[model samples]
Target: MNVLLVSRGSTHHGGHDAIHRLAAAATETTGVPVRACFLDGAEPSLHAALDAVPEHCEVLLVATHLPPDRYLDTWIRRAVAHWRSTRGRRARILVAAPLATQPALVTAVGDAITGEHTTLDGNPGPFRSPAWSQITRHRRHVLVCRGPRCTAYGADHVAATLGNRLKEHGLGDDVLVTATGCLFPCNLGPLVVVYPDDTWYEHVDAGLAVRITDEHLRDSMPVDGRRPRDSPPL
Candidate 1:
């Protein structure tokens, strides 16, 4: 049996690396092929990962949320069932019990403690943060999509280029850049959306990111967003 660890993916490669280490550890102990796949924001999405598994071998899926996601437990089961129904594949896919319900959860927490720990104090909620209450005075808001498709296409470079170029062009103070999860129309990613006027750009790379910093954010002209493609069918 092959082990597939499912995780809530991240835009940063470091996040994926941590999961990879976990998968490697599992493979070492279980004496089986163990791999990692993301739910979103990283490559080899759940569907793509599922398709890669050979039909001859069964897959044992394990979820990797430490505190456990509020909805992931229910969502993954339904999503997997939907995939199995739609794909009609033969190999068995069994989901391990949700991480939240595992008896080892409490034991794992207890084992981690070496130094003294403080009791829970839930006062001063997230909304109480001073930064959260304040709005940015920046002139433009730029959103860079870090969804799985975009990341696969090099959204990380695009994002970094935007930031560096904006600072170089002296637009950093005037422009706000945010790396966001899944700005849709994911087919035309690495995607960038600039607001106050909602100018959308698709298939952006480092080159286009620099262009956006110079032409759109700096000059206030929405850069050319289309590629050399003919009109779509009506």
Candidate 2:
């Protein structure tokens, strides 16, 4: 067995520690060659780590935290495709928690490979297609930009306020609020994006945040006037 561990930093802690722990355990249990990939924006590409996997080794991808949706999906698909095309049919794919919880990951891997999606037992229905869609539809997404300029202005307060308000509204589970490093437009100090419509807001404050919850989040109204011209593609 050839195990490949990949992890990124999370809101709570960096994923490197968890990846190392898993690699150690796998090496002990299966005596397999374990390769680890720890990304902190200051490390090498994951491909470098994948390239280190020994020949004819079954690949296990473990993620300690949820990764950016777009990038993770693309990588997993590419990996599976490469394995299928070059490594024969003996290659097996396994993912650990957090990434395992992501519907997109499960769907992409399941669609690309053969075999049931199981944790330790039967298939995890929660990770199945329909269930995954429902979970995603209801999962709240909050993106806060804490770019250098934004941090200088007050992006930290914006993130804290949003998180506090979400908890107060009893919508914490339905909301995923995060303060990201940058969203470009460094001049715009504080910025936020609320999905599934990807509504962008600039110069956000507490009062505006409340309105966001009530009008846009609660009532589903479109955010007015603050959308960015270079907003991420839908």
The Cα local distance difference test for each model comes to: 0.77, 0.60
Q: After superposing candidate 2, which stretches have Cα over 4 Å from the reference?
A: 1-139, 229-234
TM-score of each: 0.55, 0.40
Candidate 1 — what's its lDDT?
0.77
| lDDT for each residue of candidate 1 in 1-234, tens digit (9 for 90 to 100) | 888888876537898988889889988998999998876555555666777898868988888786777455665675577567767887788888777788887787787775477888887556566788788799999989976557656676788788888888888679988878886677798899888767789899888888898988999877886432332754
Off by over 4 Å in 1: 1-63, 67-106, 110-115, 119-133, 226-234
Q: How much does candidate 1 score in TM-score? A: 0.55
Candidate 2 lDDT, 1-234, residue by residue in tens: 566665542334354555667778878888877766533221222444555565556677665454445555445555456545644555456665555566787887778688666569875565456555564445658787754345444555566667677777787677677667667865555677887676788788777777777677666785673555566666
Cα displacement (angstroms), candidate 1, residue 1, comes to 16
Candidate number achieving the greatest TM-score relative to the actual structure: 1
